[model samples]
Target: MLKDNYGRRFYYLRLSVTDICNFRCNYCLPDGYQCGESIAREKPLSVAEVNTVVRAFASLGTEKVRFTGGEPSLRKDLVQLIETAVNVDGIRRVAITTNGYRLASQIDAWQRAGLDQLNVSVDSLDPQRFRAITGHDKLANVLRGIDRALELGVSTKVNSVLLREHNLAGFEQFLDWVKVTPVSLRFIELMRTGDNRDFFASNHVAGRDIEKWLLHTGWELLPRGRDAGPAKEYTHPDYIGRIGLIMPYSRDFCAGCNRLRMSAQGALHLCLFAEAGIDLRSAIASGDHRDLAALIRSAVCGKSAGHQLDRGFTGATRNLAMLGG
Candidate 1:
């Protein structure tokens, strides 16, 4: 297994297939935001290059791969990428994190392509609030996508970012809706990234407060015996679904961090808040698999202990969308 100097084993890769998105989320990007000229002109990695990167990670003990993006469904060959990742020598599962705007139409094709899990981002259950948050009128479509994924037997999870008075006020409604669904709901704390730093000052809600409210409102705190990524999960014995909180800023889960993030442009981010990255695109384009694997190992071994967000440090210059969310 690929272990960092901190003794954290690397077994998961969050690969961004594209930086283009269909929504202009209030907390993800500024209003009227457009793709930068450089990003507009640059091309994303081809399926062949993505396949080679996945193979290299699989050889280095990567067991789980999740395709993320501004919206992964926007990628034309996403199903093919899922298939490629799932077929990698040591990969056990392949999943995606999407906005679900275009998912319902392609869910079956994704299943056939060997997708094992889905994490759909749906911030508000209220259609009006949803439109206000996402700057889109596709809440109905997203709901349909979620229901279809559940109906099709896909292990689906809904992720909502807590935006203080904005979507946080809708948590009760969200939980009520989840009780009838076959999927879990996770509330993610707003990170103060470069793209949303201004909004963070007004909208960021601590995940602990959200968890406290959940517990106070009849939700039972379940013991998370082992690491389950960054989310702290809970459940209601009577409810069919689970609830989770991802608090990157309020609570640092770095000791258990075991994943690496590869941007759509091919930069390998060792830490989400780190400004610097290794240009794996150049390495992959110029080197052989063995050399690429060596570079990956070297990069992982040098992963930082934790991000400096607690010290009033700002996050990466790129927005969550650009960083694959």
Candidate 2:
């Protein structure tokens, strides 16, 4: 397994298939995709290249591989990518995090393609509120997609970004919906990225508030999975579903970091908030698996203990969409 200098061992891999999202989310990308002109001639990693990357990680004992993106569903060969990861020898779980645009329509096909889990971004319960937040009026359809995933017995999760004075007031509504649904309802704290500094100041809601509320309301804090993302999950006896908080600013947030990320263009991101990255595109494209594996090991060895978010340095991450949610 890949171990960092801080005694943290990596077992999960989050790979971006593309950085081209269609959502103009108020928090992340309010004006839709803005770098189309700059990247118009740039092509995302091909299917074979993605396979090479996944195989290299697997060789290094990476057990979980998650396909993320500006919107992973936007990529035409996303299902193929999932299938490829599923076939990797050491990869135990193959998942995808998407916006659920084609979920309701293509979920069955995806299930057949060997997808083990799914995480969809559904920022709001109310269709109108959802529309206002995401700039899309398809909450109903997205809900349908969630329903289909549930009906198919797929492990489904819903992620919402808690924005101050915007959808924070709808926590109760989220509670009501999750009371019976079996999916995991996660609220990600609005983080201060390179470009969202002003917006973060105006709307950044501390996740601790919600964590306190959950404990006060008889919710039981659950233990974190070995290879799970940074979400402190909670469950209630009465509720069928569970709640989770992905609070980047929380104390000791990065102490348990066990995952590594790679951009669509093949740059290794030590942390989401790390300065740019170490490029492995050439090695990955060269089809030299041994060289790529060596590079991954060397990169993880130099991993820092934590991010410097408390000091107000956002690093090379101008926007979350540039990497993927």
Candidate 1 accuracy as TM-score: 0.94
Top candidate (TM-score): 2
What residue runs in model 2 are displaced by over 4 Å at the alpha carbon?
Answer: 35-37
**Model 2: what TM-score?**
0.98
Model 2 whole-model lDDT (C-alpha atoms): 0.88
Per-residue CA lDDT of model 2 for 1-325, tens digit only, reads 7888888988899998888888989888888887754455457789999889999998888899988888999888877988889998988898889888789998998899988789999888988899999899999889999999998888988899998867988889999999999989999989889788889999998899989989999999899888888888999999999999999998999999989999998999999988878988899999877789999999888788888898898889888887875
For residue 230, give model 1's deviation from the true position in Å: 1.0
Clashing pairs in 1: none
**lDDT per residue as tens, model 1, 110-187:** 999999789999999899899899988899998898888888888998999988867878878987887877677899
Q: What TM-score do all the candidates reach, one by one?
A: 0.94, 0.98
Candidate 2 clashing pairs, residues 3+ apart or interchain: none
Look at candidate 1 and tell me the lDDT of residue 230: 74
Give the range where candidate 2 is weakest over 10 consecutive residues by summed lDDT: 34-43
Counting clashing residue pairs in each candidate, in order, gives 0, 0
lDDT of each: 0.82, 0.88
